[model samples]
Target: MRKNSFAIGCACFLVFALLRYPQAMLEAGAKSVTLWFQQVLPSLFPFMVACGLLLRMGAAEIVGEWLKPLMRPIFGLPGIAAFPFFLGIFSGYPMGAKITASLYEERKITLSQAEHILSFCNNPGPLFLVGTVGAAFFHAPFWGYIFLFCCFLGAIATGMLFRLFYFSKSVNDFIPYQKTPSPSITECLPQTIADSIDTITQIGGYIILFGVAVEAMKQTGIFHFLGNILSFLPFSEEFLCAMSGGILEMTNGTFLLSTAPDNLSFRLTAACMLVAFGGLSILCQTLGVLRNVPIKKSRYIAAKICNSLCSGMIFFAMAPFVEKYAQKTVPTIAFLAETAFTIPIFYIKSSIFFFACAFLFALYQRR
Candidate 1:
């Protein structure tokens, strides 16, 4: 009770402070709003609607069965997890949580399966990583792709690790429930669009609030206090400030990181780690989607930490190669990079992983 009250008090104070600094608030708020309108909504809306259509048409179940061998063996999750699992990677952010929670709500997946999916599914989408972070921020599209790939690997590694430590279920343990095939696009399209808009609007609100709050904190020197508190970490104050911004909101963190006096390798690794973490704004959105579910937030946070660390490790390993090639700036590579990820390797790999996991899970169940 006291904690809740304290949180409310803090919120009130922040609101008051922001109101006192209107110019800072507007500048911070506007960029987040523009990013959402210019980038996030345009990219996410179609994906959300398409996913809505696909799952409704029973494509998920069909593909889940086909890929059971991989998913079960690798992730120890039911085949049905493949659809949203792939969406989480490709579509980005709370999609994994949204799709997984929707599945659980419909009784398509179990609580354990939903929570496990949640651990690694809530990651940055390719559009942001490649388009915004990679091209706009780094001036290299290939680097964005590299970060996306690292996060992909990190999510998979996290899934496998969770299979070992968290999920011990057999493939056959998943409750095989029938799905209602809604192939009526004529009837569904309008509703799907409406739902997409609503969801995207809510997500934009989170982005705006977090973005503005981070900028406010920076202007108010709240991060200075944070830097002092974290001074024991053996890193520079600038790095600490960047990380602090990241913990609050990813976009803010990304901007701050660009100003850090670190080498490309160090900054790239940090950026990759931050993207993998998905920041508090995204996590809040995920939890909001899963509000009615019985899963714990700590598990989700642990998953983010584990995946971010894994991404950091992978980035370090790939830095030598990435930096070498990144210097080449091959025009051919850009075209290929642009066209190749469009082919849905995320879906293909997920299917294969699903199939593997299913095969192993069935074997485990039989034993």
Candidate 2:
């Protein structure tokens, strides 16, 4: 039943893409597809390989130890669950799901812990936000930090909420954690790279398909129609478009909002909300990962709702300040402020990157 449902969803998405962006599909033929494949693989492959090495080396154990205290208080997750929690937050949605699967397979963490972590663990890093969404798309670095904060806060809130209301008594009936055998760095590196590449290759089709659908939606005036419908509301067209896009592709959706005709305040608000929701693209990826896991969609949806509301409230509160200050401040000053704010979040972001690297390092060192 679940498989059939997923297949139907994919078919619907494909049909929607074809109908809306016939030209985009045509343009995205072999050559374009190949180029995208090439571009994404090189970077993604090595990262995945590193991730494998890290897992093999017990790098997660090391980071989990360091993060245990902080995470315990914040989310009430067990120490070992921290690895997947951080993985989800930093590495992106399904990555966290992947880590949870690994832990489950290894009998490291219980199913209950995995479910709890899933409530808040699946977020992308700040770099993806500032570099891809903010700098590349929005052309405003400060907005990226704001968006990150909103998402972070939302995730934390959801985690706490789950702990309060949905605390599960059933522990994971898995194997006890034992020291994992390690491998050589040279062996680990190649393997990690290979694994990462394989993962990207597995998902690359969905990414491109999504891109095509978005382009089709734009060309077919679906966004315009959405804007028209949203016009009846008090918010600007940009906010509505962003809300729609964020649900589709969080980063791209927010990017569109940044380019909307409305004021910066509205754009900032929408961007934050989109990020908080983890966007639809991330949600789909999350669903893919949780397919084999025993996660409930209701929990995920509740988390998103909480995220949207919290993020919206935060942005609205800051709207006047953003509007007043953003225009008056020089780009240089704003950039400096962004840099200052990014520095701290970057540390939090690095937890995932560092964990990935350290995992590989441990494997190789042991080898």
Q: Which stretches of candidate 2 lie over 4 Å from their true place?
A: 1-21, 28-40, 170-177, 180-194, 318-367
> Which of the numbered candidates is closest to the native, going by highest lDDT?
1
- Model 2 residue 299 distance off true place after TM-score fit, in angstroms: 2.0
Candidate 1 stretches greater than 4 Å from native: 165-172, 177-183, 229-234, 328-367
Residue 7, candidate 1: alpha-carbon lDDT = 80
> How many angstroms is residue 68 displaced in model 1 relative to the true structure, after the best TM-score fit?
0.5
- Give me the displacement of residue 115 in model 1, in angstroms: 0.7
Q: TM-score each candidate.
A: 0.85, 0.75
lDDT of 1 at 268: 83
CA RMSD per model (angstroms): 4.7, 6.9
Clash statistics: count for each candidate: 20, 13
What is the C-alpha local distance difference test score of each model? 0.78, 0.64
